[model samples]
Target chain A: MVEKTPILDTLTYVFLVLGILIVGFPIIYALIAASLPIEDVSKVPMPLIPGDYLLANFTTAWTKGNLGTQLINSFIMASGITIGKISVSLIGAFSIVYFDYRLRKIAFISVFCTLMLPVEVRILPTYEMAANLLGPIQSLVNVMHLNWLIDWFANYDIDISLNLSLLDTYPGLILPLVASATCTFLFRQFFLTIPEELCEAAKMDGASAMTFFRKILLPLSKTNIAALVVIEFVYGWNQYLWPLLITTNPKMMTAVIGLQNIIPQADDLPFWNVAMAGSLIVMLPPVLVVLLMQRWFVKGLVDPEK
Target chain B: MIKRSIFSNPYLPYLLILPQILVTLTFFYWPAFDGLINSMLVSDPFGNYSRFVWFKNFIALFTDFLYLKSIGITLMFSLATAITSMSLGLLIATLANRALKGKAIIRTMLIWPYAVAPAISGILWLFLLHPSYGVVALAIKKFLGVDWNPVLHGGDAMVMVIMASAWKEISYNFVFFIAGMQAIPKSLIEAAAMDGASPFRRFWNITLPLLSPTLFFLMVMNIIYSFFETFGVIHTMTQGGPGGSTNILVYKVYQDGFIGLNLGSSSAQSVVLMSIIIVVTILQFKYVEKKVQYTG
Candidate 1:
């Protein structure tokens, strides 16, 4: 025991309780506001407890605010991005960590260079690339005189255009994000811990690298895969700036982007109850993922380099 | 950090890592290089006529008062956020580490806020601090008899954003702090206690010096986060409004490039921001990964 100071122990408890309340106050406030009726919520000093109008406020936020479509869009985008990022980084990490090849160091360095170039830094050019990819593709096709290729695809109801923009599409949202520097970095670190004897034994048995990966390496990385999923899913779900920039249509808005719309301007007599309901609805999935998968969440976040 | 190859195929490794390499080349390097090139090009309003203008955009950006103000704002915001979040995080972590009951549950509750989106934290704070009809704003008006209008006041908006960003980051700092504290050997602390060093004295002398590495790492992370990741916070909360008082560098780049349509200047800003990131990254590799030591 450090000490038997009852006063200090009580202070510690008090500090912990206060910390929890302060940390949780926003969420608690959102919930209470979501449940309260408009009249109650409009008052100067709103009630702090949950009210009976939870379902009503939720229906208003969901149906009227167009949150349902946004939520679905968010789910689709998040899943697409998560799958894309994980698969790409998985194979990339596999080759880099477990194999020796030409320009291996160059490949590793190129991926590592991305750590310094976040989306925010490369904002304008990335937007330009996503919005105008057809320019270069068309020039290549024209130079190669591949008009039949276009006609061949056109026969199947696929009309390729000179101004083929990917904005507001699922692939558009996911593709630019699929290349994850840290994912490969972390997975490669994980693969290094796998014993060298296993690889030597597999070689002695005449097993190919792909077979070894499928049988031994994949199964060995279940924890890493799970941790990666939680982290990537949250990341993809919470994307704000990229979606806000690319998707101009409200129909394609993710839940996070939908937040800007749902929030009312200060001058208006906005329904605080409805906005609070929408906020809670937006936060529900990610928060639930954290609470339910608490251990994996902690592991993924704390030990990123492990 | 190098792992020997289990297989000996030249084509297979290239095939495996090709997808990530292609994506990185397409998205990251190309755009970054484009930004660098764009900073050197002089373009008209429509970009219909552009000529090479070496260093002119950079000169324009360095001389602009608004750009300089944004730089100052970013520095202040990052420092304020890093200090407040880390201190509060350390305080809570110490308490949680010693508390007797519901320790796991408390840690869970404390850490879940890390999953909340930065924009959501912005909205949450906005809800509480909005000038008209905001709950906390109303409380302030009634209790302190001051007009608490973050919407109109520049300083108030800055404070609101700082609070929101720090709130979103506290859980992250707390988790790392707890991990760092737990890694310290118990015998050292027990021996110090046996030597009659008071709890406060022991903490100031022993725990702090030992936790310096984690402290340095988190400080760097918090600074980087404030520089780039607080875009959502500033966007959702202030939108760099009230005459650009809360406009950080990231927000300025976005607003200038996208909204203001000054591609050259925006690209210049991006170049400057990228340089900052490069320096910070180097610091992390040199300090954090190197187990930067502090003598007790």
Candidate 2:
């Protein structure tokens, strides 16, 4: 931009146009394909132009793919993750930034440590734990030879065994995924920028920590909360491996995974049109969020301090 | 950094952090610890017999040709995906940064791909490249006279997954690259331009060096992206098929543990992956710390 020579200016536009073409080609093709008739979709060289079957393909996809349930599941999961992660992270960040506590350093380190252990790295164990939330405790009791203690208590008509499973449930889908430190770190970084005088003023007013957080800090965090919501919502909606691992029930499957179900079976004709429509449906929500909240999304993604 | 004026409530602080700590411990530490323990314990496929054999599973993993092959494949895939995506991202970002018109519209158009899930992106590419009726596949066969079936060809499958992964990641790298480009002081560029340096020379001499930190950060992020995040892409695309061509480490762990029921090997693989992530994360943090010092 300092000295944009005419030739260089033309070259820039040329490359950008080419880049956009290549980048946009797949989605454009999918749109065109999705609009085509079922038979046209399977043509050796599928029709390039849009057709009249857009609604028909979408209808078939929605009905056959069980997309209604899947979309609802995805919405719940994405919203749950955004809300749960933000609230937990907000409080955790508040504790770290605004309070002096004995275990603060340990808590910070533990949360930071989770950054390295993404769900993929601990998939099997996480699945097993989700299958039985109390498995670790049960194992510990067995390891500690506390069966006799339980038996003794049982003899006195007391039972101490505990069992819970999170699989195929919304909490299961949301909670494990929420146990990351990105949002906490982001909030902590943002909190560090706030003036110390605000806390002093709140303290002078004899406001409780909770009240200050509610009345002052929460109001200040609106932009940050919105940014993180955009990022986390997209993240939650796009999750595939975790949901695929835990949600065995069709009714519980998220839209991204459920898109697979809409694909015609191996024996059936490959109705690429219907599948393309389903792909569009599954992609719409997160795409819309990103487009609508472009500023916050970019800030959440690129802000180094976060 | 603690605030100068702060709240001092021991119980409330603990209560505030308790949810985060509890969720982390149960979901992260518990599973990670279980993975470490399970890595040492060999169990039959049916889970009827089990015994702790310290480091045996890891030793077997290193010795096994298939596992070693998988490691090689994963490294290759990660590098290919990262480099392809980063280069394409840089190209677009550089162009977009220079263009004098419609900057916002161009950015909006290009960045929507970032929102497309890897699996959905894979499906989109699949429709384009599917063997029987895929438009591009047919064109390649017709014009190039080359069979383009990912289903049957290992090389083709690898290319397919890489294309899909790179396509999805370009928007992320593009966003970062644009930010990096904008952060480079315009005065520096203008001074270079005034000094009779060619556009290419100025960019190569100044812009590239200044952009190295962002480049390095994006490199690590992209490698991590291809390693773990592309599970959906590989799963939906080829399922690591055509004779185990695309079986990246993450997908292999899923396959071995859930499908093959090799708990010991799977757990060992998970430990290896965790260690890989930790090392990469440490490397990133170290570089980031150095960058902070340099900038400060």
Candidate 3:
């Protein structure tokens, strides 16, 4: 900005325009392709302008691609992960920042260690664990040769080997995705910034920890909660690998996964129009979230202070 | 990090933290520990029996040609994606910082790509580059006379996945770069300008060095992104296909474990990836600590 010459200003505009075009081209192209008729979609050099079959393509994508059910599933998954992560993180952060427990440091370290193990790295075991919620315990029992102990307890008709699987379920889709170290750290950082006087004043009133947390801390965390909700919702909605692996039933798939189903096989004639429409349908929610909640989204992303 | 005036009720704090601790222990620790154990165990064809062969799986991976090739492919992919995304991000951020008008509009237009899921971005690119009917593919064939078939060509497939991955990531890098640029002191630039320094000279001398911390942070983040987060792109776009040309390590782990049913090899791959991530993360944290010290 300092001593900006005319040529430099012109070059700056040129580069910015080029950047926008490169960034926006795919979405714009998808928008145009989604509006095309079925026949024109496969034509070489697909049309650049919008077409009249927009509603028809959307209808085909909706019914044939099964996007309606999938969108609902995505909504449930996204909202579930958002609310669950925020609640647990708030309480987790509160405990770490407000209490003097002996195991506080250990708990923090354990939670922080989760950052090193992404879902992709441990896919098989995670799938196994989700197949049986008590799998680790079962493995421990087996490894320790505790089968005889279970058998001895079976004399009273006790079923010690309980099977609880979370597969093909909402909790399975949502819960594994909810253990976020970043959100807990974010809340911890925010809690550290709250003045000591507030806690002291609340203590002078002889208020319980829960009362102080509920009455003051929760209200104070509105902005942070809003920002985190935007980030987590987008994260949840955009999830692919976990949801794709967890949900075997087509009826339970997320919208993003549903887009794959609608794409014709490599051997089959590609239906570019319907596929693009499906892509648009899949991307709509998170894109809208980013655009509408732009402020909170930017804050959650770029601002470490949040 | 605790408050001076703190809650002393021990039971309530435990109750409060129980959900997160339980989830982390069950989901993260259990799975990670299971992967470590599984890496050492080889099972029969049927799910009948297994025996421990410690370090054998890792040795096999090192000796296997396909696994070695995959490691090379992963490094290349991560490096290419990180460089392409970060350079473009820096360029755009610098330009945007200089522009005086419509800055908000330019930003909104650019950052929406951050919201586009990697799988969806892959699908969009697939539409543009499908060999038979893609508009851009056809245009390239016409203008450049190059036979562009990603389905059959390994090199083309790599280019496609890299572009798709980088396309989705540029916005993230751009956001960080913009923040980094904004954080630079204006007086420094103004003083350079008053000394009759060219904009290029000032940028190269002062701005770039000052932005090194942000650049380093983005480099680590982008490497991690290309490593782990591009799973969806590779899955939907190439499926590690055309004779496994586009197979990154994360995708290979899934394919080998879930599809090939090679549990030991896949778990070993997972362990390898975990180490990679840990190293990169530690590097980033070190840089962050240094940055904090410089600022604080």
In model 1, which regions exceed 4 Å deviation?
A134-162, B142-145
Kindly list the per-residue Cα lDDT of model 1 for residues B99-142, writing each as its tens digit. Answer: 87887899888988888888988988888887766787887789
Runs of candidate 3 exceeding 4 Å displacement: A150-160, B291-296
TM-score, per-candidate, Cα-based: 0.94, 0.97, 0.96
- Which regions of candidate 2 are displaced past 4 Å? A149-161, B142-145, B291-296
What is candidate 2's TM-score against the reference?
Answer: 0.97
Candidate 1 yields a Cα-based lDDT of 0.85
TM-score of chain A of 1: 0.89
Residue lDDT tens for model 2, B1-296: 79999988759999999999999999999999999999999999997889999999999999999999999999999999999999999989989999999999999999999999999999999888888878778877899898888988998999899999999999999999999889889998899989999988987888888888888888999999999999999988989998999999999999999999999999999999999999999998888547633231
Clashes of each: 0, 0, 0
The TM-score of candidate 3's chain A against the true chain A comes to 0.94
- Say what the interface RMSD of candidate 1 is: 1.4
Please give the lDDT score at residue A87 for candidate 3.
98
Candidates in order: C-alpha RMSD to true structure: 3.9, 2.0, 2.0
C-alpha positional error of residue A63 in candidate 3 after TM-score superposition, expressed in Å: 0.7
| Candidate ranking (TM-score, best to worst) | 2, 3, 1
Candidate 2 pairs with clashing backbones: none
Model 1 lDDT per residue over A1-306, tens place: 477778888998998999999999888888898899888887777877789999999998898679989999999998898888888888899998888776889999989878755788778888887887665576467667577676676655344458868799988888888865988888888888888898889888999999999998899888888878877888888888888899998889898888787787766666878888888888888878877887876787778632
